[model samples]
Target chain A: MKKFMNTAETMVAESVDGFVRAHADFVVFGTDRQCVRRRHLTPGKVAVISGGGAGHEPMHIGFVGQGMLDAACVGHVFTSPTPGQIIGAIEEADNGAGCLLIVKNYDGDIMNFEMAMEMAAGRHAVEMVIVSDDIETARIGEGRGRRGVAGTLIVEKIVGAAAEQGRPLAELKLLGDGLNGRIRSMGVALTGVTVPHTQRSTFTLGATEIEMGVGIHGEPGHSRQPFSTADDIVRYLCETISRDIDVQPGTKALLFINGLGGTPPAELYLAFNAARRFMEERSIPVERSLVGTYVTSLDMQGLSATLALLTKEEMTLWDAPVATGALRW
Target chain B: MKKFMNTAETMVAESVDGFVRAHADFVVFGTDRQCVRRRHLTPGKVAVISGGGAGHEPMHIGFVGQGMLDAACVGHVFTSPTPGQIIGAIEEADNGAGCLLIVKNYDGDIMNFEMAMEMAAGRHAVEMVIVSDDIETARIGEGRGRRGVAGTLIVEKIVGAAAEQGRPLAELKLLGDGLNGRIRSMGVALTGVTVPHTQRSTFTLGATEIEMGVGIHGEPGHSRQPFSTADDIVRYLCETISRDIDVQPGTKALLFINGLGGTPPAELYLAFNAARRFMEERSIPVERSLVGTYVTSLDMQGLSATLALLTKEEMTLWDAPVATGALRW
Candidate 1:
């Protein structure tokens, strides 16, 4: 793999160290290892926290700042964080207003974060919200095994704005759940990621082939198909996501097109152009749009489309100001 | 080519359309052209206007917003803007405080923007500054043929802030020249970019080969050598830059490590870590650092390191609050 690391074992740790040192003015390392928290804690406000594997950068860690996540427990690449790390993040984020865990519905992540919640039961009030908005799974409507991908940013922004307003912990949890339920996303990959220490990629495909419905962490998708034009793939992504959500005439959404690591901003805009055209024709207006690389798998050449059907009121939350490294606006 | 576009001919135009529409709140297209300008113009302030070839995003276009660029003239992919487009951008940005055109030092761009100045003569006051900081060229010290790369962002930020402060056109021009002279950058590429409709990369390398000093637009570098570890490359880049500039014990600089499009943020931090270590050992302090994909090539799997030596006062300007889609604080 063409990676920049001393060792695969320390790559995540070293990245965390570099990130903490770079943003030292605005953030600090959490008390209990492998977590990033704000430099100053706000007392008696609902605290928002999220965590997952380390490879998907600017996700959990980059979201730790003024208006977004309060703390982020960084696990090993494509691996769940330890329960102790999650507990520490909860402690740092909790300011007596209680804390909320934004779990990304992977079996490993859900288990570890819940374990951390149980571990912190006596110290602070904590709640959990499972974000399973990835609609690539066969049981999309059932929402049982759906994985959370780029849509987590939507949940984080909405829930974070409400939490920053000092909403009660219960209200914040409900906000996350509601927003998560309304969000749907799917992705296509032109190339798979090669993890550090591995010379080969997780999966290989022909030069002119694309994988549809792929997961972020090198997970296999429903099918390996022929490579198509950007407009056609965007149309396919939009159609799949709309089927999983309710999109009728006059429905408004925050269309977020994310580059999964290797796609350039220009290409992302290309996808956005096609998605916007597709939405306009279908009579579903994209009320707001964010096109860039957000939650990315390490060096994965792909793009994901997320359409979060928004309530008129919720639109205000999504548009609310944020000051994170990745999602600042 | 693995690009996202409806057609190669319309790729740049379509991306501009989507970008203007996505950021419609903060920006708008020029009255009758492809240029992007602030939605609400601040007349009577020294307008900071910049433009060049597209593809290196978040540089000239993404830098547009509150405290940075007043207008950016975007051109076709890897091609300079037309004289008409640059003229329109100047007309939109100038509000009697005079307009400053920040042009990258490319033969085509210099020739075209200069032609535009001649076209807009007497209609609006205009002055120009050329940024030529890329040090990888054979005639590096001569500075005439040096192509401006990632270092252009530093020139834009420093000059933009001064312009926002209502500095006169002459002062902004001087600041742009001073900052551009103080910046130096070099890059290496692991993979070449495939322009739309080309169906092939600009260059090819063996599995374990890397091209040193590659330009942002797939321009050939000085040499292609065997792939090395991140630390080794960081060492090479730092040593080369330090030799070009002074690296005495007490020197302070802003170490900006940029991803050349396809390199992920994790890998960028990896590069940052190596650079920090190298600087620390040399006793050359990196007073401030900005790490992310600021300026990027289109799908070029590589990275560039830019070190802008700064005085004590310049850090405050770098830390100034600016709001744009790509950069915010």
Candidate 2:
């Protein structure tokens, strides 16, 4: 497969520099490797930070701003950002109000961010929230945790809004925990994406098949099934999310139909429409919905749906003003 | 070429339905054709609505919400939304707030949206803003008229924020027009994206060649040149945008490094870093920047850069809170 870059080794650093240059106003370099709050540490506002593998474009970095994360430590392509990077970001974004690290439930990310938090705790007030919103059931005996996927965006938005409202660290952590119950995400891949350095597709799927519940780093899904119609796909995806979450009737929901890189909006919408019909037929009250490529997997052609149950208060917070690269509400 | 769908004809409609379902709170549908404001339209807030082909996911639909677009009419894949669809969006979103139709400068989108605007004018207060941000030299002596591409996002964001602040129709049109002078965009495509129904890539580029100035619908670029480093590509792209706008040294600008779908974030940042280095070397002040797959062309492996010269007021508006599908800030 053809790729675009100077060399595989410089890919992550080059991307980070470019990202900082573009958003110089809201993001800046910290400790040579991490992105920190452009604003001076606010004395009272609790700082929120997160990071992970670099492939998810707006995930860790794009989410840094006033209403979301204050810093994001970018990792190597498909690898967790280094603990040093995360620690630097924490130090830079932390105000007297304290800091919260929002780590995805990936092993690499968890390990790196946790280490960073521990390192930071030696000198500063820091807290953390690990988001594990992927609802795909894990193997019964393996004890693997649900992977974090698009649902991270919902978590960031909610918790970020709360942070922006100047919620204290402990309160914000509780809010993050509360939101954990309301969110669930699942994804499927029709085709595998090629890693630029490897110049090889990360995982393989047959032309007429899809792997349901694929991991963001191209991990295999629970099962490989034939490519199905949009409706079938939606039914399968929504069923998984609904089975995992007790989405009751009359409850408002925030639905996110996310593309994993290469899926066209047309296909995304088709899947989105089917999902909506499925939910409506079951009397699920979808309060707000988002469709498009929010979280992606390079050029993998598939989609993920995240459902965020909302109370009036959570909806108000979700409606709060936000300024970020990927989400601007 | 693999595809996803039960039928080609129902693609756009199904997608729209799905978007509405997911964002049910802020999104409302009209007669199975139009998606519009879920916020009760105020009696006098000027509503801004836009639409075009389905391929540009967030352009028309994703912009819907507070401080951006009130509604979007979606067309078939790579096809303009029908006049009826556009008209319905205008009617549904209009609530005494004279509606503003922000159409991209594509012939089909312009023609179709114009027809719909005319159809809606007799019944409600309406206005329009046609965005032509693609800086590619228009057909010979065609003056400033060019196809609209990624720069439309800046236009939509600034103008949408203004409209959300309850600007009148005339003022919103003027704000959009004022933004036109400050904004410019250029793009490169490494590979053509295949439209689902056609099962054929829209345009072709050699394996080691890149198409500069490519259109969102896969129109040919100014030239196909040998693929080069991300810095080289960034220099080429930044030069085009800078020259087009005559960005003087020390001028503050909003830079958008937009993905044309399949390009990975690493390459995007590499290019973004190069562009930043270029701008900094030239002493250009990048006030705010966004790097990601904001506007895309299905799975086209490419990127576009847009520079918006920021006035103090526009910068504030740029920092304003916004809620939409693709962006939340």
Best by lDDT: 1
Q: Give the Cα lDDT of each candidate.
A: 0.83, 0.76
| Chain A TM-score by candidate, in order | 0.96, 0.94
Residue range B28-114, candidate 1, lDDT tens digits: 888886588888888789888889887887677888888888999988888899998888888778898888999888888998999
Cα RMSD for predicted model 2: 4.0
Which candidate's TM-score is highest?
A: 1
DockQ of the two-chain complex in candidate 2 = 0.48
- Put down candidate 1 lDDT per residue, A82-192, tens digits, no spaces: 998988888777888889999887889988998998899888899999988788864534335898999998888888888888889999888888788889999999998
DockQ of each: 0.69, 0.48
- Provide the lowest-lDDT 10-residue window in model 1 chain A: A135-144
